[model samples]
Target: MLFGAESNLDLALALYDLGGVQFGDFDLGPTAGRSPIYLNPRVLISDPAVLRRIALLIHHEIQADQARRRPRLASFAAVAGVPMGGLHLATAYALVSDTPLLYVRPDSQQPSIEGRIIPGQTVLVIDDLMTGGTSLLRTAKALEESGLVVRDFIVLIDREQGGTERLHEHGYHVMPILRLRTMLTYYHECGLLDTARYRTVMDYLERTSPRRWSGSP
Candidate 1:
């Protein structure tokens, strides 16, 4: 019922309406290439109420994970966010859950673990989306190098473009609030996405996802 959606389907639609999901041709980046759909959870910031709802949902997930005796996120000391997207999400989570926060700077003079982050402290890395797993891996490595332990990665959306599998293969765990397949299917079912665009996006996912998990080049 959070974000004024009665069900996950409704929530997905709400996200679509909120500009979190966009259709039509797009070039995510040189490396990301062309795609028919773009998911930007950052849009949620324009509507504080909606963003708060998402932050709350993420907080609940963290709490639930902690409740599990053997949960991977049960022992984190702070929330470390990947730059751009993860920063806001981490700020929200820290506010909602009163959890400590860790930031990894993009500049040369990165903060030391002794002051900013305690050495040997467990951390859960948060990000807005995972496309190729590069940012997540970089953030994890940065944290580890600074003496923080990173065992979990959480994101608002998983593009389902093999990023999750890649992280898993590297022995890092990932959690996503919504998946690309689920989002695209919901849009199609709701008539928000035309048949052509729907097929285009799904086809892209199919073509690209295999290479990631299959260990093929």
Candidate 2:
């Protein structure tokens, strides 16, 4: 169990219940050709109880990492969320943890980070999902440009499509609450997902995984 069995299963079931996990052919833009399962954490926003559960899980993960003396658990002054989907999760986490929240506006004429702009502050980046790692990188760049340090990222779900690897290559630590494979397996075992869909997602993940997979949790 990479991220704990009970909690991961709970979140997976919650996502399924909230209709966040859809099984079908989905166009994931140019970077991700096609995906059998589409994870939309944004749906959690409509369910505050589940969203708070997620925030608690993320907070617990950070506390656990700090307890283990993980090097990437360096003290961060604030939590920055990637725009659109990530912002909502970040906001929930911030509210529950009593931490300041920040966000980046990459599409602006002059891209900038919102919230208290404090130079030399370390920030924990948050996002709803990780696919190609493009959004996280862009947000990190924006924060760095604004004199903030970003060394660790917290994503609700990792699609396992090289996003974590790509972020690792750039010297960033990613902590995902749940992996797509784990969620799919949990769903299938719980009778929420049919065998055909489970196999489809597993094959998709295997085919799109990095060539030199290190199998990091």
Candidate 3:
């Protein structure tokens, strides 16, 4: 689903202004590899205004999806934030929407989930970004184990990697507010990103994208 162009641009600018979007040769751990661009929405927490805007954007998107009768996202009874980064967004969303919030705490011998875990309750998984989807999948597995149902996953930004496809293969749906490619294009068009930097990030995304290139590099 596409958000309004103005809203998208505003969000892109806000992310860049907040230092959430960075251009560099940063390491993305072993699984995700290196990239020319990196997005860290965790910075949103440092700015309450931006964080609230983000939460509202998510809330609106979910409402729009429900209005369109997208059952997977429309039928969720609660929201679950994928730990560490996602918890903050989930908390803000829960506060705004009055929806029950859930999270898994796998820090103990008997790992368990927080919030009211009614069996068979549908949960919408929330996260800041998507790379290979390992964290989201793990969170979903934990939720399912606790008798909660998970079908819809939402993120602020999608890295345009294999994350969405990977989750789809596992029968889960992903909804990203902004895609890295789209943001890059916007930035370049608006002069926020130079031509060279734009091309570099675009090329990097294509080469590392599982959809374009087979197997991990």
lDDT of each: 0.80, 0.87, 0.86
In angstroms, how far off is 111's CA in candidate 2?
Answer: 1.1
Query: What lDDT score is found at residue 48 in candidate 2?
Result: 80
Cα lDDT for residue 214, model 3? 64
C-alpha lDDT of residue 163 in model 3:
94
Per-residue CA lDDT of candidate 1, range 1-217, in tens?
A: 4432244455566677888888778998864689877788787777787777777888877777788978866478799888878888888898998889887776657643323668888899999889989998988898898878988988888888878778989998998888889888887887888888889889888777856557777
Angstrom error of the Cα, residue 35, model 1: value is 1.3
The TM-score obtained by model 2 is: 0.93
lDDT of 2 at 154: 92
RMSD of each predicted structure: 3.1, 2.9, 2.8
TM-score for each prediction?
Answer: 0.87, 0.93, 0.92
Model 2 per-residue lDDT at 49? 82
Candidate 2 residue lDDT tens string, 35-121: 887888888888888888888888888888788844556779899999989998999999989999999875797777789988999
Worst 10 residues of 3 by lDDT: 1-10
Instruction: For model 1, give the 10-residue run with minimal summed lDDT.
Output: 1-10
Q: Residue 4 CA error for candidate 3 (Å)?
A: 2.6
Shift of residue 190 alpha carbon in model 1, Å = 1.6
